[model samples]
Target chain A: MDSYQVGTNTPIKLKVGIETEAITMTYPFLYHSEDDDTPYSMISPFDPAQKPGWKQLDNGNKVNGKFFRVVSFLRFFNSFPDEETFNLAIQQVKDTYEASLKGGDVSPYMMAFELKSFYKDKTCVIESELLLT
Target chain B: MKKIVLLSVLWSSIVIAQSGTEPTAALQNIAPPSSPAFVLMDITPSNIIVPENIQAFSLQTISAFSGDSSNGLSNNNYAVEFQPYWYVKRERMDFFKYNNLTTQKADDSEVTPNDYTGYNIFGDVWKRFSVSMALMNGTFDVLPQAQSYVSVGARTRLLSFKTKSQINDIKSQYTAYTTFMSSPEVIAIFAKPGLSPSEINTAITNLETYKTIVTDFENTLQRKPVFALDVAAAYSHFMGDKNQDLDDAFGRFGVWASGDLAFYTPTIGTNSHVHIYGVFRYLRDGLNLNEASDLFIETKTDYGVKMELELDKLSFAYEYITRDADDNNEERSIGSIRYKINKSFTLNGGFGKNFKSDGEQVVLFGIQWGLDYEPSVVLGAGN
Candidate 1:
């Protein structure tokens, strides 16, 4: 992947519940990569279909808006059995994700994302990061 | 390992090849003609049938015809009487995945169990890990060597049908909870005392409507509520037949009732596959057959094994039938396995002999053709 050109050509997938609004889906590809040291392919909060403006780099040439990603931290967070237990679990995942970026593993290419769903008036906001290795 | 994989690939290719080709010419020759529609009850002649005939014949027939087997011979004596018997069985089981008790898709449709069209459309619910209601098919037959035969009886269940969209309402879906929570049964389980009658009536009404639609579609008569949302409603006076106008309503549908039938065939026939014990019935019937014989009990019995191979349906059954009276007991052993040629058709051949010393043993060869009815239960998903 290092040798391959990273541009708008990257393929990505969307994770959706059994039923969801089609238009608001977070799609693959529409993500912008944060760093070359990390992998791409992360779940992003911004719906790519809207084509949000990308952040400008110090050089400020618009960075061409190539890779954008989000990570599903659920794989790490759901292992805990309860909410009271999740505070530590969430910190652990965030710390692990941060360490991966510094270790040149996958964080350089990923970004954090959130999913908000309401059932029976119980609102749960799931915080997770998308990463590509 | 590679050869096994390659062989599997080759085998699959052969099966596909075979699946594509027309059945053997023998299939066409043995296939029963659709014209003699009443052939299911046509027990006048000794014959074997093929599966094609069984399928062609309607399931609505009340005939006592047995399906064909691969074996040619049958010593089943109960195939004579036309009386029908009833039986019931229960199978409730559970399902597990990765050892975690996770939420699963429940069969929440509100439909009756016997509605075939709905059954074919909705399929059985996999609620829990239970086969749910795997094989509750009812009724079977017995041999005539015994004066009295036995039949086990069981209850018939009705389904409460509800659509996927209905059962998975948006609120329930988003909540990751069961939409079927509204069911009368579930509501009762989690009911809070002091709820108003109107509030409770609404829930009971839902179950009532479900039962109405299901019975109209499957049964031949109306069924009063066996279980109701309101215990008061359930206990209220029985609602016997001022019943809703239904084309397919049943006479009556009760919960937890059972029935059985017993009869005998003067000569050997195919209904012998009905019971678990052969000698018990013979001894029981022998008491009736050898009455007024305290001094000298004269008796003759046949111990033989027969095979049936009419159609592809094969059976390897054994029978060591015996007859014992006040003074003497006679016994014999008979066993044979036969595979049917086509559906309902069998080519049976077997041998057996009396258990007595110097007993005459004879090889029996004959053809048995008849239809065997198989009942299947269709279930709905849980709420």
Candidate 2:
């Protein structure tokens, strides 16, 4: 609903809000510039001790353009009881993000979070795209 | 009848004693697979069961309880089926891989629907796995009167195969959707200044092209697989009479497999299919009580075939199954009809002769419903 001004030196801040009863998780937002079609992954660092909630992506020079696309992947959790796997996956995602900050090459963090096989449908994919001008 | 009432009261007392509350909520929330309820009613089309759809959480009751003598509360049966997968949490880190958006080509080409078909098929099997539990009050052939029993069961799809047409249809729909998303109209809507998320959604959905493409794609996705195989197993336990020490006797144990061959029948309706099913099961029965009130076991094997015509919201099916045991052979022939009143509720009825019925006809009716809870999504600006 909100459009961003491109070509400005000001940083672009994008925030997403979710309303759901299920546990919610999100992947790093993918930013694609009109100048270059390649998608740049933007990660929002979180304090491990705090609860996960809305994530804000702040992009400075990388997002300065007339038009760009922001792709976000959101997952909602269901009542399936596999907490062990969920906790482990969350930890791994955080670990991968931390490693990437140190110039790690592996993009394993890009893999979709895994759940026990049958409960997959309990989850829904909200793949949204935001257009900036 | 007196004994049945006493056993029902005893079971109710036990439940209340354990939970310290009235059993109304708990009783209303139990649902079993329709096939098993048929078996309990002695009107099962076949002993080998293959449930059509499994919900995350479902509830079913045989007779409505009105807290009055006329409503048959004592004879009520309740069962529940749930998928454990929905109970677990899952997180996907590799978004590109899960959505099949990753491409090796350097040109930044968009991923096609063909890229998604494989992932979808792989996920379909897991969605079919489910577990069920039921509490029922009924009379078996060897029992002098109705008694309470409990059953636990599980089912899963063993194999599923879709036709080439199904795959191609998905690909075509995906291509259309991709084109529609990038169309000038869509881009203009997104480029509009000061448009709210809900407003944008409404505008897009109101478009004729958007509606057609989405509805067609969804309908295509809902088509039945050309062929599928499913397996299930269940075990039930009988509770002894009210006056005696509770005899936790094994009531029935059954393991079965079923295969379905379905053909799309769009001529009848956009969402219609003709299905042929084959099933086989091995069952061990122990509800038979002798004069001394001791339970005895019987081993039997059953095989059957069924034909069903599914027309959008209604379906009609007929099946004949033969049961063979060491000392006797019995047959079950039944015709059944089902109508979906809505997404959350359905009505089912079946009539015919059951195994060992000695030509006595049986008619049974049932209802199934699920507790529908869905998460809502809202898009807004970041503060």
Candidate 3:
């Protein structure tokens, strides 16, 4: 509303877009489980084509771009069958340091994921250097 | 793969051109003053296609048109193709199925009626990785009485090369155009000196009237490229949850970018298009659109320079832009003419204009009555 001026005039109050990325490529609907959680049935994977470009000037420690992944299907259905179930699946595969994600969806994607459960280091990895909007 | 075999042979020739019942034969090749059916989640040459599960059913009639009579009418409550009537005006991008799934004191708390669908497709194994899981359901189908909404989106991409690719010497046809990149904070706010650089270049050339939307997003991000990106994570619920009356939820992002470079093609040896396309859409609802009276939010960021030349039946182009809602809005020039009007017709006309005059100044008339006729009519009429 009359304040966008990223020119020689500079003003530029708001309204600018172009940040892309934070999530690389993947597809492993390939399964391996223990009543499932081989990373949660691979949480729906099949991205025929993806690029993850733009959003440079990565300094400020990279910050934003990660959206929790369905609240870990609500803590993996709130822990269905556990005996320490790999330490509650290693606290649901670690990473997702909870910077600005208290709940689920509504513009949430700091794009985090870095869990490690023994027996094959249980992977969920999606911390692609975080820098997407 | 060849666009999934040309959309599965256009969905089996539109289901054998419909017979017994009236599935409407692919909505009669869509777009009779309202063609809307775009479902190609994402294709990048700068995010050239992220139509978002697109679903369209239309036949608008509130007693309109019919005056100068080019003829089209019916009686219905469905008015699709009003730029997709912002699709059901955003009921959280729509997806419903709630036959009672409550949860409270009975189990302490649960309401399984979330029927989430905020870009959730997560699973596309080998056609190359693509994952999805969107669940914002907040609201804002282009300001649908928008006072609140929330969104969360996720995306992925990779195709360095395998299954079909060749990197044409690392893409960049032209990137040498910067006269000291002027931006002394935007010429120090309309610099003084009796103010007159042609009235600030004819009022910023009125943002070059959008040069036909920068030649239709630079001719579909250079016809097609490889490895694309589009991330749309949004969360908005303006006015939050006031007594559940709600209207202030927020978080946002909508980005589309692209990159492609491949060469050597006698007729498909190894080819690539889509040099670079970077799109970004955002919204942060502090609400207060000046207390609403014409609440506005318009932003279509840009930075472009592209060229293509595909001979043999011909396909050529040129686009140059640095847009931000143009007033002379900077640049655009497209001149196209494709004519195959035979084997199922094809005749698209063109000519886009705008040099620097803030966005959308037009004229691009078009026609193709069934190109030789087989349910084909590729038009481009603009103004």
Question: In DockQ terms, which candidate is top?
Answer: 2
lDDT of 1: 0.25
**How would you encode candidate 1's per-residue C-alpha lDDT over A1-133 as one tens digit per residue?**
2212223322322332211111122222222453443323222322221222232222222223444332211211011212222333233323332111111121233334444322211122233333333
DockQ of 2: 0.07
* Cα error, candidate 2, residue B358 (Å): 2.7
Task: Give all TM-scores, in the order shown.
Answer: 0.22, 0.65, 0.19
Per-residue lDDT of candidate 3, residues A7-49 (tens digit): 2311111111111111111222111221222221212221111
Angstrom error at residue B145, model 1: 14
Q: Relative to the unseen true structure, what is the C-alpha lDDT of residue A82 in candidate 2, on a scale of 0 to 100?
A: 32
Candidate 1 chain B: 10-residue stretch with minimal lDDT:
B228-237
- lDDT score at residue A57, model 2, on the 0-100 scale: 43
For residue A86, model 2's alpha carbon misses the true position, in angstroms, by: 19
**Candidate 3's residue-wise lDDT over B322-349, tens digit each?**
5464122334444444444332233333
Q: Is candidate 2 or candidate 3 better by lDDT?
A: 2
lDDT of 1 by residue, B18-56 (tens): 343333333221212211112111121211111111221
